[model samples]
Target chain A: MSSTLIALAAVCAANPFRVAACAPTSTDIRRQAVAVATALSVAAVGLLAVLSEAILDWLNVSGSSSRIAAGAAVLVVGTRDLFIQPPSPEPALQGWRAGIVPMGFPVILTPALAILAISAGSERGAGTAVGMIGAAILVVAVIAVGNIRGTYWRTATVGSAGVVFGTLLLLNGVTAI
Target chain B: MSPVSTRVVRGVLAWILVLGVVALVVHPEGCGQPSSGEVNEAAVATVAWFGANINDDGTFVYRYDRAENRPLGGYNDVRHAGVLLSLYQAESAGIEGAAEIADRGLAYVDERLLNTPIGLVFGRGASARSGSVGLLVAALDERRWATGADDRDPLLLALGRTLTGVVNADGSVGASINTATGSTSGRSPFFTGEVLWALARLHLTFPDENFDEPALRVYRYLIEDRDRVESPWPPVSDHWGAYALETMSRWPNADDLQLEPDLELDGPATRQWLARQLGLFGLQVRYESQRQGGITRLTRGTVALPAGVGTLGEGIGNYLRFLDRFEVTDIDVDALNERTNCVAHLLTNRQVSAAQAQQYAEPLRVQGAWFRNDITQMDDQQHALSALLLLEDWMPQ
Candidate 1:
């Protein structure tokens, strides 16, 4: 498979806010924030997909190299996710602003994820958009599981999923060369 | 939020290093790199192929479609000179029998020279293109440089005159001379670069001759006018341009020659752009490596013709030689070397081996030849030989 789905899956798998379900914020607010983040991500990634051709022309790189770079972006996040603790974004920020900041910007829709979307989207077109939607669904499901199943689920995911998928992400990127 | 321990990071890094080392050992060509020894051997085999294929009368098996098991009918006059030039390069590389093989090829070219009003050209056809004349000059220059043989000096000078006729006063290049009319017509940027290289080499051999001014003007045309007047976007892949640029680097006070009263040459910019073109050639090599049959071909694209692919080697190889010979410090030498090495590695890896050639209907036809879509032309070896010989020193051990 192309690096698109792999990168998307890796991004979801390494989502820092998988444990955000355990936060004291109300479930409606949390879901609303996630939905807003997803919308913003879709809009930005869509733009990147369209502009990818022009961007590549400007940079004097190819679609293949960009995809390779997309894979490398995953590796960068993979290292961060494997080692560093997920940022504890305070609840002092309310509404969709949380989605714009900690959730959209860092947790769900990350730099690596954006790169993957742009490259994969440019290369495979609808295939990447479909993968992005699939990843968003998976990320939401992980959080839902954490909310329903409580701290035990959150602890298990935080302890294992990031390390496992983060390693996979690194492998995915390494395979690019 | 705690970061992973330094000890853990160190342990992980150690494992990665171990895995990487093992991977490299298991499949050394993983990065598309080959040692110098293999490339040198391949170069010998290619020259041997040339030696084996030459007819008693000096004609080569110009184009062979292996699947058809027959020699395809067509001959390129420029390629005749080209093959001779490669043989000279091979001889310089110390490959045995290369000079002898080149002597036969040179005889064929000598017999084909047709005199025109301006000077003698290589063909008796309706038109004798400047490119063929230019290549003829280059081939002669290579022979002289390799063996110090000046017996054919008259023929070389005559061809140099023909090429000079194609170079206009303003440095722009004409396409060809009408053999009957004795008139020059058309414009070709590529033909101009070929002439430019010929003039540069001619100047080196006969420094007292006025070949330098023509060469400088052509160089100026390439830098300033070729793009505007002749070809547009998706510029030609120019091994000749690379050769000309590199040869210019060796000229006495090359910087002084780089200037004109009305137009100042941007030497660094031209080198960078030409270097970028070489990188484009390297890109083709990389993409070609990625291509495979079945579903992979659909994704990665079809294999490039071996002649076309061989030019990738020629482009980067000449550029590398340019970099090393002149030691021009403007471009990133390390990166250029790496790109050159990678192309050498991939080309060497992809070349037909003896054992593999045994499976073909005619071993000689298939042996030591690079084919794409089962078709191998004379130039597949010609360009590859030039590239391989020039690339020998730069290759990683």
Candidate 2:
């Protein structure tokens, strides 16, 4: 039990999902992986709004007004992005530096990840939560390098797939609510 | 390039080689004398010079000429007190002038100085002043043990008693004492640890029941019952934690106290922590490069300057000093070397007026700058002194 606990703690603390994904496989690989991971994580955060109720019921959690409020915030952001006319590409390109800025920071691994951490921790115990986080980090690492040389269609497909998955999660959350 | 210019460049290169050799010769490593011996000699010179100049009452005019003669005067008391404690660690160590240095240092401490809290010790002069007292207490305790003196020097005894007064009924030491109102500041780990380390040493030396009570209380306050609600630990509290843990480890009956393993990270763990902390030192180098890349300074900045760019230099210096005293080896000396070289480069290249650099960077010179700068000197001197004492102790005499 102690060893299990230790392993869990190590996983949680290690956050391997982010770690594996974040490693610089190569410059080209880094850029592609980060783009895919960022789109997915952001979409995941957005889908939380649609699936908030389900998430709460599934986890058997309550009295987290703050969590609901945060979900609303993510919903507003995702909705705005979906509706708003796309801005000039130059500014967007300048904004998202490869692996250093949004991709490294708030996008792939962020406060939402931390929130997921807290939820995972409270529900499944700290060790399991940490392990999940590690898994997520590993996922990020794989995605970071794997998508680098893919064509624009492949990149768009990955982004579209993330949006679809996020929408499904959102629907589940709402049904649960 | 012209022949004359080429010749001049060659001359400069040759001169640089010569200077490098000279520096290496002057500060040789692994020599029979040990590094701490050099530090001790420097510290003693600082103390003796201060004693001669700063009258018994701890008041003196700042004479730049006299200051030039003893450039280390600003840091003399604090650095000397630290070295005195280091010297106390040596087997067959002499405590010849430690008492006098302690007396001179203690004369400055009063209710007014005692009122300032620990965090403010950096901004206010209280930490440096109180820290000197702490060092002296540790030194005097060692002196008493070495000499088998039943009654310690009266001044030293008085100072020890005064330190006790700094502690309140609760384990905390009042930040500073209001001389007029006789009031004290709120309790803090930084002050409490300084007081505790000193009191712990004194208790070990004399086995006083009175000292033990507060010492234990302070120890508990600092370690077991830290402010976990707001920020896992209190700010400016880790230094105290490190000091308390290290000092406790040295106690004859330390095994009685069940300290947490995490708090008492072993040498390797501690060294790793030290390495991570060195990253901040690296950041400071980056910050310096950004700030002064194109700027020119009069004096080629070197290792001897008093300005501390960041907490990393101070942290590295403190940790190294602690490690040396604890006799913990297996440290990543290469990492330390890299960090030290970074700091050396910063100091050497730091843009300062020719006059200021001339005065500040002179060997053994102390600036009237903040105590952080002064602490760098104290930390370096003590680490060196401890290393020397360790070497001397192990020497096959």
Candidate 3:
């Protein structure tokens, strides 16, 4: 697999959905605002994708090593989330800050996500890999708003997909006998 | 689905993931970089594979089908000689029983020799290949070196002369000799190097003979003409060139060794050529390291055939021998050493283990060999064995 896509599946599995769901905005405005924030996340991710080749060259790292590094970072994040119930990450905020805060920052633009973005871009083309993530985030934002139930229950499907996919990508990178 | 059940399903999956990962960790036999001890064990197993498969009639299985549990047809005398060389090398390295097995293989090749104007070449009539004859000389020479015996000197001199019979004045080498006519014809990029290597070894064995001249002349042809004139795309990575230098590097008073002046060969020039050859090998090792069974294949390219990668190991191991004895400038010894070890690591990772071989109908035929899918060839073991033995000491303890 493109280690990046496995990483993408790892970081995106349930993160944006929960982040969008827990957004403090009213449901009416939430989808539009999440869309805006998600587009911004896609841009930032695309930026990393464009720079990934240069970044790797500067660091004297190869594409395979970069993929492993990205897998490792995503794995750690996913594994941590699996054991500890990750809080609905961003705090409650008012105005346009709601979109930019939780959804744009940590929920959408997480460290694991950034690593996956660069890796995907490096492995596949930036246009395709980042576009896939952009498309995924856009879809997750709509689902998050439409499916929100209650803060106590948290629309609550477990996002073990990240953990599962992270494990898959990590093992795939392991040289086999 | 209700939220409660959804949460329960997710919880179940999380626990299952944990259990699955645990299962993998506990039973991951033969994965990742093998320790130096494992590398030693791996080499022993590979040597065992050669000993186990040499047929009663002196030939070997040639190729084998693990899934079908049958010996594949066809054999190359060149590979036979190559394997024999590895056995002798193993014997030299303190591998028990290797010399006995090598002696048996040597006798088999000895029976196939054709008396030619060049001396005695292996194979009969029109089908004889000088490459095989070349490797036979090297194998016989390897045994003599290992045991310090001259009992084979008459045969070695005859076979060594057989290699020179094919060489023209400008260092061009014909790979095959027409036994009926006592003539050598045809050019092979591969035979070119192996023959050159054999000639170099011949020079060392009896420095008084004309063996050193052809050996030096062949080195000149190899470094200058083969690629630009013949132009095999992606150019040939001549492991035999490295092997020849290794043989020469071990010569007494090697530091002051001199080649014919008109041949334009010198220590600095030889060192540079070897360093370049090693560069090609290092690149191949790195590329092989990137190969995976997943989509990474789309990016990294599919895994190479086992023997092809194994040659990289052989090349690096031999070239490293050159570097160690001579001062090759602008090379990173540690990085080069690490890359050499990476080939061993790659070979070790790809080799069929005892556990995995049990899935085959015949496990003995399966273990200690590398297969592309279901089939493994003689050179796969031949090169991997030579590589493991050649590079064994450089790997960390």
After superposing candidate 3 on the true structure, give the runs of residues whose Cα lies further than 4 Å from its correct spot.
Answer: A1-177, B1-33, B256-268
TM-score head-to-head 2 vs 3, winner: 3
Scored against the true structure, residue A157 in model 1 reaches a CA lDDT of 46
Residues B287-389 of candidate 1: C-alpha lDDT, one tens digit per residue = 5655545654556556677667667778777776565654545454544555566668666876888999888899888888888878889989998888887
User: Which candidate number maximizes TM-score?
Assistant: 1
Candidates ranked, most accurate by TM-score first:
1, 3, 2
For every model in order, the fraction of real contacts preserved is: 0.00, 0.00, 0.00
What's the residue-level lDDT of A103 in candidate 3?
60
Residue B297 lDDT in candidate 2:
24
Candidate 3 lDDT, B116-200, residue by residue in tens: 6667888854668878888888888899988888898998898887777788888888877877777777788788889998998
Instruction: Name the weakest run of 10 consecutive residues (lDDT summed) in model 2 chain B.
Output: B25-34
TM-scores for all candidates: the values are 0.68, 0.43, 0.65
Q: First chain of model 2: TM-score?
A: 0.40
Per-residue CA lDDT of model 2 for A1-177, tens digit only, reads 122332232223223233333334456655564555445544443354335445544543321222222232223223322433221111112323434333444334433343444434433455554554555455555544453332334333333433343333323222210
| Candidate with more favorable, higher TM-score: 1 or 2 | 1
For candidate 2, the per-residue lDDT at A126 reads 52
Candidate 1 deviant stretches above 4 angstroms: A1-64, A67-177, B1-31, B258-268, B325-335
Scoring model 3 with DockQ, what do you get? 0.04
lDDT against the true structure, each candidate: 0.67, 0.42, 0.70
